[model samples]
Target: MCSLCGVLGCDDHWTSAIARPGIYTRNTDRLARRREAANRIRLANALLEPSRLKIAEWQGASYVLSSPTGRTQVFESLAHLWPEVEAMTARALDPLDPDFLERLKQRIEAAP
Candidate 1:
């Protein structure tokens, strides 16, 4: 539920809910995509555990950067911030390269 709209899944339903009226905003969309990608990476890291990587409790929560590759990643600190950790991972990795960003920009620009 969104505090502003008092609607469930408002963020999903209204693409520009976080933006000012008639203004351009990519923060919400980018954050969402980053979150999705981060979760996938986190899951993959979990599967590779005991073989390719391992996770230890960091301050009471499971950290995902214990993986071999994760250690080398700039987003390694993401292991400490779960849930919202996706944004950290995305910024660190910059997974959305030029090509993907171009497509995303087009989509957002075309939106009504």
Candidate 2:
């Protein structure tokens, strides 16, 4: 069943198999990617030292974080980290079993 639709799993009565595919799959994929990217970016930002991150708070505005030199180096580092993040997201989106980043890291280490 589609959780959003409140349908039970593998129920043909609720799902229209012959008709055009539902938009859920594509939207779900997109949402998953967005979430994964956000998570990775957040983590990468967290890894920066205080001097590097330079996070600040504003009453109604978003905070900004950057290096002491005004260079946003965290985003540059993200490209190098994206492959691992992609694999982690893929594993997370898997229905059967979705291990968090810890297990994902072990899998990456074990991979050839």
Candidate 3:
């Protein structure tokens, strides 16, 4: 989907939150949820960095996945992220793959 449409959408993906974002009445809950969402993006980027793929929050409701080549896809849920990443980058993303894990570990250790 296009970025504009995704931004206009009111509901967040179920996988994007620990609790529903729209049902809360407190500011603290909103802040906590925002923090959780940012953390999710950070961790996902770690696994994606080797492939030169990255994802960012799209208006707090959806995610925008992009490739080093400039191709992009906007997806609303974590469920859709992997497939989009694979298709956009032309690389199979296996979070559990031994080599991928090793790369991630090395990247983490190498970070200064």
Candidate 4:
């Protein structure tokens, strides 16, 4: 008898199938990737103010960030957007800084 039979009420069921090594590994990997992507988006969004930066999809998979002044930066992937968003957030908070625009440009250009 399976160790979890008592808690699950039966030994042969969906849980048993999922317990198989191959299925468990595949499912866990897929779920982990999804969770990581969600967390990345959440962190990026939290760092950027909606009014200052606008993120949009381009060519289905790429992303673009547009500023209030009409400046735009393109990123190959959502993962590449986080650094730009972080720089924009810093600039937004310190707009009067002497080299803010230069640093922001460098940040966007350096993004992958």
How does each model score on lDDT?
Answer: 0.39, 0.35, 0.71, 0.49
lDDT of 4 by residue, 1-112 (tens): 1244211211222322353322322344544433444454454444354336777554333457878888788876454565676675553444455565565666567768
Ranking by TM-score: 3, 4, 2, 1
Supply every candidate's count of residue pairs whose N, Cα or C atoms clash at under 3 angstroms: 0, 2, 0, 0
Model 3 C-alpha lDDT per residue in residues 28-109, reported as the tens digit of each score: 3555655666787898898788888889997877788888788888887778888888888677888788998899889989
Top candidate by TM-score: 3
lDDT for each residue of candidate 2 in 1-112, tens digit (9 for 90 to 100): 3445332221132221233223222333434433443554455544333123443322211233444556432222233333433342333223234343455556557758
Can you give the TM-score per candidate against the true fold? 0.24, 0.30, 0.73, 0.37
Candidate number of the best lDDT: 3
The full ranking of all candidates by lDDT, starting with the best, is 3, 4, 1, 2
Which regions of candidate 2 are displaced past 4 Å?
1-28, 54-65, 73-112
Which lDDT tens digits does candidate 1 get at residues 7-87? 222223243345543211334454454454446456545433323444332321123444345652222233333323334
Global CA lDDT of candidate 3, please? 0.71
lDDT of 4 at 43: 48
Off by over 4 Å in 4: 1-47, 89-112
Look at candidate 1 and tell me the lDDT of residue 78. Answer: 34
